[model samples]
Target: MKIASLLLFFVLGAVALPAAAQSVAEQQDAIVIENLRSAGSDITKPHSIDFFLYFPRKGQAKAAATEILELGYTVVELEKSPERSEWSVHATRTLVPELETMKASTRELEKLATEHGGAYDGWGTSIVK
Candidate 1:
């Protein structure tokens, strides 16, 4: 009877989770797609950027990405190597915040990276084509 109850609870929890998770994911994707479309409207715009950082140890890369996102950057993606010593954070701005807003945020990100034994490698894009 104990095993039966436990199995029932697990089945119910599992059945309820996917729908919830998928809806949440779908909403986020819709928002992100809208932001991306708006941001990339200008051909000369350089908002799409990859911000790189290097940490002293494992797990710091994820921390770095979180901090950047907290600073109000539209984080597109985060890539970490197998060693987990580095992170490449992709950010694109859909709406203009204010003059010097990004500059200030970047300085803050740099400081945060330094605190984590990493360095902010600035922002750049590889190819326009």
Candidate 2:
């Protein structure tokens, strides 16, 4: 009975981990969207959204940039930070910053970063006039 209980716990944990992570990401997306709306930015119009990612190694950053480029994002800049000693990749894509769209893009970019031994820092954009 104890072994069975432990197995159930492990199974539940494994399933919940992804959902938990996604929930956090969705919450962040909502907050950013709300902030943008409050700032008088037109979320319905396509805006140049910038995504930030970081990798510990230059090779991983380069590989991630290639992948992001394939996803239709312009690789704006890829450089190593002298102070932080991490490779940073700034990519931009023009899209309407809807909540669902932002969430989906965040998930895809997060997955790509993870696969390339890096971290998807977050995203930002200027208020379109």
Candidate 3:
């Protein structure tokens, strides 16, 4: 009877693992879709545009934002929070091609954030053309 119970427990654990994984994946996908939808609705431009966003820190968020600018998007710095000691910068650039490339990159970043289940403190966008 003990051996039978042990086998049952192992089988249940195996089944539970896959279900948990699928739930996480679904949640991630939902977040990605929501982000993309919101971004699409918020940006409209007749020219190319780019953006940079700064979070609570001056390191990773800043660097990631700069990297977006380097990808051929005009950078606009939105807000710098000096009072909080951490810069909350949001930059925008105009994109001539309507920001298809920028959207793809941002989507990838969002997915990474979701999978990791960490806070995404910064967000920016490229100008729509």
Candidate 4:
């Protein structure tokens, strides 16, 4: 699963391709279907989204984000926390928590963060695009 996700991400995000291989309507339908699946039993609303990861660092956010981007991820936003002590970098591109390097506690991300003077804070989301 990790390999598949990684391959897909690199293929799609490593280069500047069209917005999506599928048409806009198809993408919207895909998002809606995934939302429905998540709801399971209720009339769930749909929202567009993607893979999400968080890195915390006061100064290293942009550097860390650049690295992830090199790996084919998309950095969405970066903001200093309410206390202004830590920075939060939100990113996406693919969902592959199973990667030995990306899995929590593996330290790959945390290590990367540290190199850039930060720490891998966390990860989030299930994405379809």
Cα-lDDT of candidate 1: 0.57
Per-residue CA lDDT of model 2 for 1-129, tens digit only, reads 999999999999999886576756666888888899999998899999999999999999999999999999999999997667899999999999998899999989999999999998889999875
Assess every candidate by TM-score: 0.45, 0.81, 0.36, 0.45
| Tens digit of per-residue lDDT, candidate 4, span 1-129 | 999999999887956454354334333444544454575523232222243234455457777777867866677887776654577776664433332323322244556666777655454344422
Ranking by lDDT: 2, 1, 4, 3
- How many clashes in each structure? 0, 0, 17, 0
Tell me the deviation in Å of residue 30 in model 4: 26
Which 10 consecutive positions of candidate 4 have the poorest summed lDDT?
Answer: 41-50
Task: List pairs with backbone clashes in candidate 2.
Answer: none
State each model's CA lDDT, in order: 0.57, 0.90, 0.47, 0.53
- Report how far residue 93 has shifted in candidate 4, in Å: 2.5
- Judged by TM-score, which candidate is best? 2
Checking candidate 4 for backbone clashes, the offending pairs are none
| Candidate 1 deviant stretches above 4 angstroms | 1-46, 82-87, 94-102, 125-129
The TM-score that candidate 1 achieves is 0.45
In the range 1-129, model 3's lDDT, one tens digit per residue, is 999999999999998885475433344444543565566733333433233233555565556555545655444563456665555545454433233444454554444333433223433333232
After best superposition, candidate 2 residue 28: deviation in angstroms?
Answer: 1.0
